[model samples]
Target: MVSIGLKGLRHLDQKPTLSKANRNSFTNEYWKGVRVKFIIQAAAGGISFMLLFLACSCYLYGSLYKSHQRYHNFRILAVDYDGGVIGKALSAAYEELKRPEFPTLYFHSPEDFPTPSDVYQIVRNGHYWGAIYSTKGASDRLEAGIQGGQAATVYNPNDALYWVWNQQYYTTFAQSVVEASIEQLVSAARAAYTKINGTQAFPYVAQSDPDAVQAFLNPIAATVANVEVDAQDSVFLFTSISMVMPVLQQFFFLLALNGVSREHQLYSKMSVRSSMIIRGVAGLLYTFGAALTQAGYYWAFRDGWKVDGNQFVLTWMVLWLLMHTHFTYLDAISAITPISRMPFAVLTWIFLNISTTISPLELQPGFYYWGICLPASNAYSVLVTIWSGGGDNRLYRALPIMFAWWIVGNLLSMAAHLRACHLAYKFDKEQQNNKGDGESAMGMTPVGSEVTIRPHSTNESAAHDDLQQDKTLEEQDLEQRQIYGPSIPPPFA
Candidate 1:
């Protein structure tokens, strides 16, 4: 049945010319074209690009946090009453917090007693995230678990748990350090108290009396309340901004390959006048269209995505349009000198394949040229700057580079158009010249008069020959005149 149907269809159908097939194929072709353009744009700077951007941002965010933590972690300032053993123990505890694994710990020794005001000033200056001040006998009090006795005082500049915990840990660790340091002093004090008053030996473990510890540590540990400090995500913002390079590169590649190439091929045969106007209009329309599409989707899903919709939308739109403009200009050029297409295509692919740095400019400084020269590189940098938010500085700084590509592209397009036109003119002239030569060669001149002359004859024989030739010419001219009217002159006349 299938074979029968196929035979019937084939028999019924008459094959059409290639031109007709093209016209029939236009509808699907247009949609396919649009899809290709979209794909290129998306691939250049689309979801994958965004994901890469996000990944870089996330990576940079983590890095920034590490840097921030390096400077602003936990801090400790201790004053001890028992010689300096208690202070040494507190310092040792603070030193333990300084290891890289520790989140945020800073230790400081103040000439004057550490105060809430001092911590506030430091935190306000954005130096320290949290601060801690330790008092002497604070450890002894912790052992007792008692309420109101002389408690080793801990002052928190920033209400960070690390400091509070540090005060606790400091007390524990310091108590151990102090216990080891002042074993002789403590032993002497206990033995003196026992021998002088006739009491028993000091207990195996050090005494853990809160009130007693407080009394002993008090003057040394100034009474200060907790001061809460808020930390800003400066690092996250910075990291996020740094990831824009990848996004820009992705976008540029899409624009150059899909959008530019497609448009160029489509309008390849259009009149120069129409082509220029249509190209400009189409570029503007598509750019705005792309921007609006992205803006609308982003606005709807911004919150869920944890990005600033309004800013993101605006940036996305601007970057999208900029990329479209770049692509359109490139298309114009590609249309003119299609010979350059292969090179342009290869370079575009390379740019897309290259990995963008987290802070490309900041890291290498030299890569700026490579990033700026290529369409994908420029687009990636622009997108990263726009999407990430922090690199507005870098973006603005890099503006000239981006602008340069656009200008150069537009110039190339103009040059290509001129070149195409010049080539076309030369071709037309050559054709016209060839046609004229062919026409001149095919045209005829009369056979006898000026074109072919009878030679002068001497004697009676030559006269007879001349008369015969003249008679022939007369006959031929008569026939020519009869057929073509009086246009041929009569030889006899």
Candidate 2:
């Protein structure tokens, strides 16, 4: 008997248990919910996430990759005024040596070539990366120096000028490439001249000697001098941190907004004034918490904690204020409009992708350049200034913008709350009037006591009978309560 019982127990264990079956059934039902409308929403959310991910990734990786690949097909404006043999030879060598893997020289010598100031303006406007100018008698000077044996006096009035923008990655890279190209061309031209004239030109030494050859090859080197207009070197960590700043802001803003919205819904039955106050307080707390959390992140990963203490504190405060304002703005939007959280989330993502830190703001086109005035952009500017030790001058310039956003958002939110309060009061008053009417019609006192009344005339009695036949005021009030009670307002009004 014991053996048989054990065999039965083993068989029962091998079979699917009731709990397991129930869990399986529950999972199936849960999965079944992901159909039709659920699928549409899920698909939309998935697409939005993908787009946001791609935009951010493109901005970060695309900028870096473009900087790396900028040497390929890099365009440099060349204004050649030396229409001589040496100048032609050097220009031809530059063009021939230009490769797909290296920068290509585009020589432009229009009849009316742009003046130096024009070239400066063109570069400043980002029309070209840099410009090379060869003076009118460059080749004449070179040939005369070679034939006259005036090696020390042999100089080409050719120069490379680069426009220095706020972001120096592309400018610096282009400058280096162009400078190297100019040196190579000079060496090639000198070699050709030596072969034709049977004498060294620049170094005034025989090409057979190694030191002499080196000197001849590098007779004159190009020096890059930047015209600084608030330009700074592109630090990888700083750029990366700036790109990440907007993401943190968007996340915390949405988080706080969603939390406040939910809190408001839960306490919606309370007076509007109380609800607004509670939401405002919740927003402040969440902003503070998020700021602290971000500060920790910056300290641990960005080395912000170990760096300048005052700057870090200032950055934290700015971030806190910005987040608070952003959350308040979203709350106000929700209160006044029928727009949902998804749209706001998408807008935040847009701001993150378009901010100046991810890509050079100056390089962007018109609409994108305008995006620099956004709150995220302002915050990025402040953080970058603090990080770069640009002092309080730059930081102060951005503070006013942040403050403005805060004030505007708070005012709009307050207005929404006041409007809600007014509506609620009106609704409550209407309900009270309906209740009073119901009591009068039922001949009952407000205390729920029965009241007796005498009929005045036949016409009055008939009207009263008709009123009794109609739906009672209590029923109407009950219906109104049913319609309005336990209802959470839509995200959009």
| Number of the predicted model whose TM-score against the real structure is largest | 2
lDDT of 2: 0.53
What lDDT tens digits, residue by residue, belong to model 1 across residues 415-441? 655554444445446545655544333
State residue 457's C-alpha deviation in candidate 2, in Å.
35
- Cα displacement (angstroms), candidate 2, residue 236, comes to 4.7
Q: Estimate every model's Cα lDDT from 0 to 1.
A: 0.40, 0.53
Stretches of candidate 1 above 4 Å error? 1-275, 294-303, 306-309, 332-354, 357-392, 429-493
Poorly placed runs, candidate 2 (over 4 Å)? 1-203, 206-213, 220-289, 292-296, 299-307, 337-356, 365-367, 391-401, 419-493
In Å, residue 375's CA in model 2 sits off its true spot by 2.0
Lowest lDDT 10-mer window, candidate 1? 160-169
Per-prediction TM-score: 0.38, 0.49
| Candidate 2 lDDT tens digits, 191-252 | 54445433435455444444444434443323343332223343344444544553456444
